[model samples]
Target chain A: MGKGHPTAARAFVDNRERAHWHDTALWFVREKRDRQAGSLPEWELLRETASSIKRHAQSQLADYLLQFEHEATANGAVVHWANTTSELNEIVTELLQSVDATDVVKSKSMLTEECHLNEHLAEEGIDVVDTDLGERIVQMRNERPSHIVLPAIHTKKEEVGELFHEQLGTEKGATDPQYLTEAARQHLREKFLNADAAITGVNFAIAETGGIVVCTNEGNADIGVSLPKMHIACMGLEKLIPKLSDLSVFTRLLARSATGQSITTYTSHFHKPRRGGELHIVILNNGRTELRAEPEIRDALHCIRCGACMNTCPVYRRSGGHSYNTTVPGPIGSVLNPSMDPKEHNSLPFACSLCGSCSDVCPVQIPLHHQLLTIRHSVKEAGGLAGSKRLSMRLASMVFKRPWLYKLTAGLGKCAVRLTPRFIKYSRLNVWGKGRELPPTPRGSFRKWYDKNGGSGGR
Target chain B: MTRMEVAVVGRTTSRDLILNKIRAVELPDVSHPLVDGVLTGAIEYADTVGTFVGSAESVGARVHFCDTDSVVDIWHDICEEFGSGKTANVGIRGLNDDDLTDDSPHSASELVVYGTSGILGVAENAAIWVSDRAINHRVSLCLTQHLVLQIDAKSIVNNMHDAYAKLQDVRDDYGVFISGPSKTADIEQSLVIGAHGARTLDIIVVEG
Candidate 1:
């Protein structure tokens, strides 16, 4: 009823050619994931184990966080806890200022995006350069990332060529991917060398070892942090697992599920700060604590941010990532966003077609579609449904309770629909019929036909 | 806000509040996952070195096989490939016996970085394990334009499970499992060989 998701999705699908390209592109990734998962005979067992580990970790999140903090501190790294996004941003800003860092280089971090850290840093006159090629492309173009793994999936090579030509002075109209990527390589090389600080998102924070693992294909995170004198890692509190051995389970599933790679090119373990440098880890609890309180939907926290759900989702593939209007998108985003703020994001849960592909591909088996269904029920119970929708539901429930009334209304409704004009049938009041046609009335109701055919107790 | 107010707001109250919230949540006790033997019968290669070379090459890395007696000739060939314009900077930690280092300044932006392998290589993903202690400088592996890793031919493992088992015994500050040269398909799903790290990865396997 809010119409936010549908309106945005309509805008995305209006460009039929681009919409088709987007759907095919994502489905291709999904197919690749299927192939990668099929290569491993223990893929299902791995998923079960990963899900069980996450369940254990989430149940004891407080203890794990405390242990991680203690070990991280003992390793001479600074640890900070932020309860809100603004607090997270302020903590990062203060850390950057403490190091007197005016130029900061960052790898792909969804946490920073959620905290709006770039905008916050810009207000304070600190320059932050996104070092990931996809992130940098979107940064230069002044756009949000459309996908988590492939941020620039929505932008074609021609668009990227133009953007780099304008920003990095590449040869005009050079739409070749290698050329565009090389040009960006040259451009980001300078930023990485001169950056005073580097920030990255933590993939998995090992509690037993008191370290973090940052995975990337381009090695941007490794290069970004290695060059700078200060490294700041920001992560949601849900990223913690119990031990270093747990990575064997997750590392196997992450890249295979995301991009169909056996593993990312570089899975660098950051255990300690480099000599003459500092490592600051910020653990953010922005809305995750509240999510943890909800028993029915708390399994959503097991997500490893693999983006497989988005790749496999039919609605997400067709609608595009921008339709969700959240930091993370697709089936996971629908459940997470509404839980964070139901009033604004209540429409997200209804965006799905309930196909259940998301749950099938989830590496940790998050039961994403089930969570979406639960969120919808909660939203409706909280009176988030529109007035007309609520009234219509009440009317349908009343008619459904009485068999005689239902049959009479069904017979009359068929006549009414047949008598109605085409324009009136497809009018604004009929939300479901906007992009669809109404079925022609049957000769009679099935009950009447069954009674005539002498079916058992049909009358 | 004043500086005092900012400092006070940044204190430990938020940590306490978050911990309190987490502690209050009542959840069913779930045991840790049993990870032993989930993956059994690792994939074995009849010819380990051949499979390693093929898999490495498939991932855009050049592979050379030689014995200890031919190590110098292989090093010379690597040098000749780079030509006289670029002198390779051999890391002092692992490649001291190879005699590949010249009087170069060990610049951070060196075109070629030669180092010896630290641990076993995984045949399944063609990934070689390197740790901080094994390499002279950790940044050299990432900053160099070309990375040359000298590995022993017999240390190749069958899969990742064996690779992790080997790594768990070593105590080091940092370690990485690099499968190939830095690559990205971020732009329109186009595979580009080099992005931020080494553009060329050459693995030379010497007889153990």
Candidate 2:
């Protein structure tokens, strides 16, 4: 099982030792929040406006898709549609085969990961190298990214040094970030210069201009896509925007929220292919349309793929990225993964603490917690609820329906809090205690204290 | 001749043929008139490129605001970040006449800071586009442990047209538009920001 594989929960448990790295990562993001927000005193207004723009765009996604196909085709960029992962894989493999590409360099495209493109490509005897530093690390380890922005954050510099030593042959014990970074640059540069074709993930596809925007901190995306004669851009259909003008607000919010930078190092804009460069835009449905059809959850399509909401989320910080067990994990992923295949991804919705920090930090202002609750409700409605969970929830609901019973149950809960041992005997109960401490119960309940202190009416 | 690259799937039915027989489909009405002069105004002032600052009051950051081909002043401002470290550069607008020497420290104040001409934003994606020109060492934007960018208020535009129209004629080179930080939630569906890029961003907006 892979590091993030479902069967690899034991490995995940071991990696929880690095929870401090996770905490530091999130704290760093939290610190950047005010600077990013301060850049636009109209930050909230801009978020509302962006949400509306994404909503309006999603409402007309079908039209935009058709328009994009028309414009892209007219501009000499081929457009292909894939309703499933297999279809997407086939299309890409065929394109590669058609071009006789042996070694393909790819910039950071989460779509390729979603479709498992590399494994399929590898099976076909095509070697694909991820040019992003974090992607490269995960590629070397054959592990899925632990975090979207910092895929290799779970990896210490020492570990990276070891990986590079084994893979790239840097002397025995060089763990310097700068030295390691230079080694990566030197190594990836060779791949960038010689690759037959480059594949990139599109950050935004401006439908009005029929252009694809690729953002990266390293210049890898530009080198990969521009140098190659055949360039392919893989994007979720949800990546489309109605006009080019809309990129401004997102540019302002995306970097600030994702990494607290004014901007990513490189934002390459490609409209059709350049001279002697062939461009292709692949629009993969792969469950996006299904998500789009659902009114309550359709706004998920508006995600600019900035990882801000995830960074601010407490549960995500503690559990780390591998625990989510999906191509895209975290708050947005919890709501998004289900839409891809609800039955298999049902566990994702339960992965939240419902603190609503995600909604607060979301650049697009997605009501992430509400969407999560909706998914949880839907999962329960689908009869997928576990027996113990259902029983507990049912008992809890029953007490709430009757005041006397509620007070009696609340008293029982308070007593249990005091009586339950630090080491819970139940294996299932102990799972909840793994990441967090159980709150201590006072001699009396908060309600009782509030009542004695005088209620809101007294104030 | 090479075989046609089109894929052959199921046979086309008469119904499909009839559907395809339609010569043209009705197109949606797109009546908004393109404003010629409206785009030009921003393009003219677009030359009003500026550098970024930290906390708006830093001395070097201030000199970056009023840059005018004086290499000595630029070098001095850059040196202030380090307090008392030698710096090596091809040239600075305000500080040095001599070429950069080996005595220069790699950084000032623990980190070296540089300015970009301006920042670009993709309104559609909520991303801020900064060019390599603003960054030091080209990879400084992401490579440095800390990076600070100063952005002007008016450079902001609405969408891709604004981005293209402003820099459409820019010299062929590298540019980037960052949206927040580099991030991913690829783990157990837990969203964590600051995955691979800078962990923090400090933006100074100089108000006129």
lDDT (Cα, tens digit) per residue for candidate 2, span B17-83: 3223221222233332223312221212222233222222221113234324443454455457545
Candidate 1: deviation at residue A332, Å?
0.5
Q: In order, what are the TM-scores of chain A for the candidates?
A: 0.94, 0.93
Question: How accurate locally, in lDDT, is each candidate?
Answer: 0.84, 0.64
Per-candidate interface DockQ score: 0.58, 0.11
Off by over 4 Å in 1: A1-3, A399-420, A438-459, B1-9, B35-54, B85-94, B97-106
lDDT of 1 by residue, A244-312 (tens): 778878988999999998888898988887656789999999999999999878999898999999998
Q: Each model's TM-score?
A: 0.92, 0.74
Per-residue lDDT of candidate 2, residues A1-459 (tens digit): 123223334454556557767667677777777676875556786677678778766656666776777767777888776666776788788889988999999988888899999999999999999988888988999899877776776677778889899999997798766667767766876786578888988998877667778777655676567556788889888888776656655665777788776565556667656445678787776766667667678778889988887788776776778878887888999999886677777777887779998898898989999999999999899987767678879987898899899888789878877787666633455444544566666787767777888667642
Residue A259, candidate 1: how far off, in angstroms?
A: 0.6
